[model samples]
Target: MKFIAEIDVMPLKEILDPQGKAVKLGLGNLGIQSVEDVRVGRHIQLHLEAADEASAKSIVEEACKQLLVNRIVESYTYYLAEFVLSN
Candidate 1:
């Protein structure tokens, strides 16, 4: 079976996001000041072949924990679903 894995990695809430802060400041300069608590993160898309949905999910989770994200200062979120093909 084939699966699509969508993952997001972000800095911990207690950590400062300089990129997000800079964007917020730029927005304020543009007269957009209502935004607060801005955050920046990475999005990853992967296609994997697995025996089943459960296996695919597990593989992706493990990959995220091991390589895709830094568990100390960052957190990761992922979703795995069977790939749908339309002909």
Candidate 2:
């Protein structure tokens, strides 16, 4: 079976997001005052083969913990689904 994982990685809430702040400041300079407290993060999509949903989920979770996210400074969340043929 094939599975798809949609993942989100983000800086920890306690960690300051300098990039987000810079973008927010830039937006303010552009007269976009409505936007504030902006935060930046990454999205990742993965397709892989697995025996079942449980196996797929375990693989994705391990990947996130071991490689995708920095446990100390960043966190990750993911959604997994079985791949289906539309045609």
Candidate 3:
């Protein structure tokens, strides 16, 4: 079966996010004061083939733990779904 994984990687709340802070400052300069805070992160989409959802989930989790996520300063969340072919 084919699967798609939607992953999000973000800095831990205790970690300082300079990029997010910079963007927030920029927004304020642009008169967007309504923004209380900002947190910037990456979104990734992966298309994978596996025997089933359980297998696909295992692959994705391993990938995240081994490479995608930084355990010390970052955390990740993912959503998995079966892929459907369109006519």
RMSD (Å) of each candidate, 1 decimal: 1.1, 1.0, 0.8
Q: lDDT at 9 for candidate 2? A: 97
lDDT of 2 by residue, 9-74 (tens): 999999999989999999999999998599899999999999999999999998999889998999
Candidate number that wins on TM-score, 1 or 3: 3
Model 2, position 48: C-alpha lDDT score: 95
For each candidate, give its TM-score against the true structure: 0.91, 0.93, 0.96
Error of 1 at 52 (Å): 0.4
Which regions of candidate 1 deviate over 4 angstroms? none
Candidate 1, 1-87: lDDT as tens digits: 889999999999988899899999999999998998689999999999999988898899888988999988899888778898988
Model 2 residue 67 lDDT score: 88
Model 3: per-residue Cα lDDT over 2-74, one tens digit each: 9999999999999999999999999999999999989998888999999999999999999999988888998
The segments of candidate 2 whose C-alpha lies over 4 angstroms from its true place after superposition are none
Comparing 2 and 3 by lDDT, which wins? Answer: 3
Task: Score each candidate by Cα lDDT.
Answer: 0.90, 0.93, 0.95
Candidates sorted by TM-score, best first:
3, 2, 1
